[model samples]
Target: MYVSLVCRQWYAVTRAVLVLTRPVVWLETTPSSQLLPQLENTRTLIIKRPQSMKHTTYVTWRDGEIQCWTETLNRLRELSIERKIKINKIEIKRHIRVDTWLIPLLTYTSLSLTNLELKDMVHREIPFGQMMKLCPHLVVVHLHYRDTGYIDSICRHANKPEYEPAELPDRLRLQSLKLDNVAIGRTILMRILRLSPDMEELHLKRVAKPRSFANEWLNTDDRAEFSQHILEQISSICPNLKSAHFSYYICDLRSLASEFHLAIDRNLFPEVSYWSFKWCDLSADTFQALKTTPNILTTLEIIDDASAEDHCQQHLHEFLCGAPNLLHLKVPKTLFSITWFDLEGIVSTVGHRHGSTDSTTTVSHRKIWACRNLQTLHIGFGCEGEIQESAENTRLIFGYLSKVCPRLQDLTIRYSLLSLELNRGFCLLTRLHELRRLVILTQCNNDKAWNVDWISKLITPSLGARMKHWAAEYSTMNLGIARARHPFTSTVKNPLLHHLLEPSIQSTVNGGDRRGDEYGHAANAERRKEGQLSQLVPDYFINGVDMRNLGQLEDIVELLQDRISKDWQCWPSMGFFELICLESDPNGIEPFKDTIRICRPDVEVK
Candidate 1:
């Protein structure tokens, strides 16, 4: 108002600034007299009702505010009406009646509106197709039904013979559609798809059965057949579809295998590069089908079912040989059992014979390295003590990963238990010049606590020189016998050895060593207090050692100062040393920060 009073030019600039800064506005109640005119030029409007607001109050506010926004709606490009409160029986029924103001507002702003989202709508009937028809320029539509009951009602109305077909323009501009927790039947889903012929992405999460067949159990065969039919329809209608996610139910594992075979046979989703499927048993036939379009799939996730058989391992090997372009592979841990021979085979297949002098081998004799281009590998193993039996195999697998996957950057290993012996193989990871991140997660006993020595072996000075991030976490399932000393405390504390090892421990220091005061009197009390503190503090590693121990702080500071001053050129400016000393060791970072400033004045620490 002050700017408008100043001059016409000033008023014009102020209006432009307001339009750019306040393009979207969220209102929980009717706009105040002061704010109404200020929101006249808003390009996007988001109406949100607080859960605490009374139903009657919401209705009054919504009606009055929407009526006042008639002129503003004409210029609106995006509109989202979301009800966060739970609706009572009365309110649900009341919401079923179409808000008289909504249709008219949509009709007037049809050409301008491009994005719309309706979430947790309590209405008994919402003409979704009709709304899309009215807004011909809509590019994205997200509909989250309140419950299966609402979806059933919509399906019933849509099925009516006298129901008028949605008025659609010559070409639909919609590119993305997301349906959450909807229970529409096949025909209704087909009709929805028919509206958006140029859709690029579609997401259907937790989709239930139609209202009429909510309790009906379509057998595995029937469900798979129906799914194949739906996918076929989608492929035929949306040629430009790039990504799709949908949950599946398979009574028989073979049904899932059959579905994949049929999809590949028909070349469904030929251009799709990303796919996520729920837990299922993949058969050899499915792997064979995957070979049909080897290079097309870039990201694939197949969650494992506990009851599923592990017969797909061989099939997976064959699939990898055929699809050498896969960049991301995630599967159950049991499917992968790396051995020395596997490493040799991979090296020979990829023609990466570094030290070998065997030049007589022909190209036909070499196998195709299936995952030559793989960058991210996630292997999830079951918690049945299997990891213990194959501990050495796990080590060999890690040691050879860089050799097999020269381009590997990210690796995640999930298992039930991990042994310390695996550390030897972990040291080989330093060979991966391009590797940046390594994560190991295990749900097992912490009986064998990992210390700085173990961490140092894996993240050796050479590897640490190039590695950006690495973490190892263990979650204990049951309580084990307690040890006398804190799990990480070393009996012989040599400053030189401490400086070299940089052990990762998990206990805080108690002022001084009271171990000799009494056998089990005050010492027990102190140990219990330290144990409680350990439980409160999360596990963090400094140079692979637990960050709780302050015993090696002096040694660490001296070592860092010396390294930064002498070998500063060779040291990683953003390496693990900085990560652990300055970043992970929050309570002890101050000392290292001071040391860096005093010693390496030229190096900047962030």
Candidate 2:
């Protein structure tokens, strides 16, 4: 008998004891008859279609599997009622069509569900309106509909006729509605929205105007009218909406604004903040729309889209300087913000006034960010010249963030791996006392002079008191800073370098033979030969970081490595440490991990 349970809140289990208090339960397959009664405490039920079977076999038994799944859930629902325990959330994940198991499950357990998420559902006639009708108490609904890519519907025999809707709700108790990939038809979407008067969030991603009935598609003329109506009347329909995200539509926001001919006073989002620009490309119209956002707006996210130019994306520095009340600003890999943040790399102290380093000499007064309340940020810093300057600039970046955003708890930095001299000025981060999670993602750099092995000088300090392993599991710090160096042309004398050496070279490393050195010169020549290397796995310069040179990786690895030394304890809350490197160079990642693993043998290097 196989049993699995998943929960958001984690608990510790020893060899002698097991706890069944998990709130989130996943019914990945139809459970045995004995399983239902034990799952009465479940608060969130994630129903997912088992994906082990091939298309042919799945097509054959799809209906039967769904039926059994629904039957099991029905029994679970009965058990919940008997125990007076309600399942609050139901997330139907992967390629399962909602129509197959949705109505059947809800028919028995409608009152139990408060939150519903139908993700990656098949594009077919879905009884979404009926679902709202059944689960009138549902507060949050997330729906994503896409044509099933894995299964060719044309080749398979038609299952029964498409599902017909039986009922519709009058007034829904909804607070949030998220639609992805035009999940529902125009007729049904309107019906659901009209009912959800008190909706607080409407997140629309690549939504389309769907046809009402039959195997029909979109009507362009009808779509035009509906699009305009949706743009204009959405605020009126959901008057209580506080947040909205409209993203990745084929149609332009500028065109929509022009076609509607909206007045200056008729703000599209008067009461809400539109966050779609975070993931989607920002245009002139979208950039201009930010001007109308009220000072009360706290969260804003905009990602770098290569398709859009610099002017269209606007400046991140400008936004930060302006939005003083902003609690969160997330801009991922955006070149729009990489101007100058004046943090001086003080190689040595010149003078100290009142035992404090002079900020006037160190920090630039030219530009300053006013977003003092910022709690989370996803930003990148870049420079035009050599990447080493970026490494020097890292201290300044961390110093800037620590000063301006004192409340920052989560930060994701994007930059070149060569630029992340992880050791140098890492002490600046210890000032950010609230910083719970720090993620560093390396932006790709094709520069040939990349040397990650020798960035920081050996000023090593462990950033923790001895932290417990279970505590590390609860929180994590991730740094992904591995890029493949151009296969080295230079040869080294270290015996540890044998891994990257030829067998003939390896044999002669111990003896005073010239063969190893001669072979090393030849291997270096072949490594650089044009069209000579097939990069399924690149032969990286593995032993460039020899044991003698291990000090180069230094305290940067120690602070980031989680296991603390005896003396160090300032950054006491340090937890899980994750280091992700290059996929092409399997050898590139190992050298760094091998060094760290020697220190803490139990830590998994993956």
Candidate 1: segments with Cα more than 4 A from true spot: 1-127, 130-156, 162-171, 178-181, 202-231, 244-247, 250-256, 275-281, 303-307, 330-369, 383-397, 409-413, 418-441, 444-606
Q: Name the TM-score of candidate 1.
A: 0.47
What TM-scores do the predictions have? 0.47, 0.59
- Compared with the true structure, the alpha-carbon lDDT of candidate 1 equals 0.46
**Cα lDDT listed for each candidate:** 0.46, 0.48
lDDT of 2 by residue, 179-218 (tens): 6655234444555578777888987655542332222333
Clashes per candidate, residues 3 or more apart or on different chains:
11, 1
lDDT of 2 at 52: 61
RMSD of 1: 18.4
lDDT of candidate 1 over 339-405, digit per residue (tens): 2123222222222112221224322232333565688787654322222334333444554454456
**Model 1, C-alpha of 79: deviation from truth (Å):** 11
Q: What's the distance in Å from true for residue 285, model 1?
A: 1.7
